[model samples]
Target: MPISRSFRCSVFIGVSLDGFIARRDGDLHWLTSRGEAAGSDLGYEEFIAGIDAVVMGRGTYEPGRSYDPWPHEGRHCAVLSSTLPPDADPRVTVHRDLGTLLRELEERGTKSVYVDGGQVIRTFLREGLIDELTITTVPVLIGTGLPLFGPTGGDMPLVHLATRVFGAGVVQSSYAVDRTT
Candidate 1:
């Protein structure tokens, strides 16, 4: 299925001013610095409230899956992975392909989905499935760490929608997808 067939999907992430999402050791301490306005979540709460479902990468969902209290209590959550045990909760469906997963979500009347996790977001963006992106750039930079985006096959130019200063040094910019390449 073509990416356009899906109802809608967006990516929201926070990166350092230099484009690192976490340290080389996967520590997110740089993103938690109060002096750099890292405490702000870049309006993710509002964004999550507006989404009908959330699709995340296996690595991203793994840690949260072991939570004593699952966070996505009432929302449809899909973990993009074929390795997940089948005994997992029925509410959580494991998928191997992004296209197939998207098709299923569309059939289920999912109006919108939140594509989260670094690798997962990159995959969605690379496939031209993301309709919008809301990225918050923190003021600090991690010399070595995971970047918000990696090399993709093509160039994706975005149209600036709006920007907001959340608190202190945290500023989020919203962009619309330029589908007409």
Candidate 2:
């Protein structure tokens, strides 16, 4: 039955209009150089409150885990990597199999899941597992860097939900997934 179950997964990320999430060397210099009042993050607090767990890739871990903030402290965090140590964090778990991970979460009656990281979000989109995507696009553009949406095998459809404008020239858009034919 194709692991039939209803699971709600969301992607909350910041990307440049050209589609890069960060500079080539993983430096978010472009993002940091922007004005202090740039971009609207008004809905972020509410968005975070609606999720039960979060999944992210190695590259995405640094920003969220740095400075002892413990971004996902209260929520279950799944780091998708085969190389990470088994005992990485008390609140975080490493996962290699996406299916197994979702199944486990579903079994626990998890209501919402947040998928972070460019690669991780792409994977969820490709697998038709993501239900919503909320992307904030900054004004600046990085010529060569890590892209938010890499080359996918096919097209995915999305229904526009809402948009928010932040300080400086930042814009945020939200979309609900539409099953692709």
Candidate 3:
């Protein structure tokens, strides 16, 4: 049976072996240190290419703001936060509720959405909104840090789709949320 929805929501993120997205101080040095070989992004380029927009939490948006040229340049990016100031970029939108954000995206004819950030992803998963997830796990383990999966109420089953191994023991896996189960 084909899954049907007004818009598809997906997650593409990197996590430590122990399931941490960033270190104690919100540093992604563990991930950034793994320099990419020429013309290699472990399928990230392909993944982002298919996404129509991005939805992230305040935690994720703040760090991205530090980038010389915001990472999500051309994409329609929605920051889910109530405390942050309004976005200066016209492409970026500030939303307080995920439902409203999704509705707005649907109205804008968004077909696929890339849901990011630890807290944002967790919330989407808890609400049974995520359609798919592609998680790349790095080799190193940060004992204390921000975990990717915080208590999400109940199990959300997934069907394995694909897996690829990159240099330095980085493993990327994709899964489709098994909503029927």
Candidate 4:
């Protein structure tokens, strides 16, 4: 079944000033060196308030496993990986494809999905499945790393919804996919 417009897939991530989401090694310490801004959650609390579940790629999941509090405990989490063991984590559901995972979420009456990870976001954008994007740009620039976006097959037109400055020099921008194009 086709996904209802009511069910939205949104990407909320903090990227470097140079567009890198993380270092080649996936180290995010640069993102935490915000000085006085380090303590702030920025708009993460507010943005995640609308998310019903999280969908991420294995690369994201592997590193996220070390997060002290285990971020997606209460929310349903789906990890896209064909090689990840089924019992990798009790809190997560593993799936090999996005369509099947999304259909299951739709059937469960999910309204919002938070799409995380660099590759996963690109995949969603390539598939034209992402409805919105909320990107937070940190003040530092990492010369080389995993970029927030890579080349899709074609140009994607975005309609800017809003832009705001969060604690320090961080900038957050929201955009809606211009499906009319």
lDDT of 3 by residue, 61-141 (tens): 877777887778878889888877775556579887766777788788888999989999998888888899999888887
* Clash list (residue pairs), candidate 1: none
Best by lDDT: 4
Score candidate 1 by lDDT. 0.80
A best-first ranking of the candidates according to their TM-score comes to 4, 3, 2, 1
Q: What is candidate 4's lDDT per residue for 1-181, written digit by digit as tens?
A: 3345457899998889899988999888887666247457877889889889899999999988889899887899999888899798998999888778877788778899999999999988888889899888889878999998987778889999999887778888999999897
**1-181, model 2: which lDDT tens digit per residue?**
2356566999987877899888888887676555246734447789999998898887787566664777777788888876777587666777778777787788778889999988899887777788898888878767889888865567777899998787777788999988654
Deviation of model 4 at 4, angstroms: 6.1
Better of 1 and 3 by TM-score: 3
TM per prediction? 0.88, 0.90, 0.91, 0.91
Sorted by lDDT, highest first, which candidate order results?
4, 3, 1, 2
Report, for every candidate in turn, its global Cα lDDT versus the true structure. Answer: 0.80, 0.79, 0.83, 0.86
Q: 2 or 4: which has the higher lDDT?
A: 4
Off by over 4 Å in 1: 35-41
Clashing pairs in 4: none
lDDT of 1 by residue, 89-172 (tens): 676888888878887898889988888888888888778788999888777756778778987777888999999876767878
In candidate 2, which residue pairs clash? 38-167, 39-166, 39-167, 40-166
Which regions of candidate 3 deviate over 4 angstroms? 1-5, 35-39, 87-89
- Which is better, 3 or 4, measured by TM-score? 4
What is the number of backbone collisions in each predicted candidate, taken in the order shown?
Answer: 0, 4, 0, 0
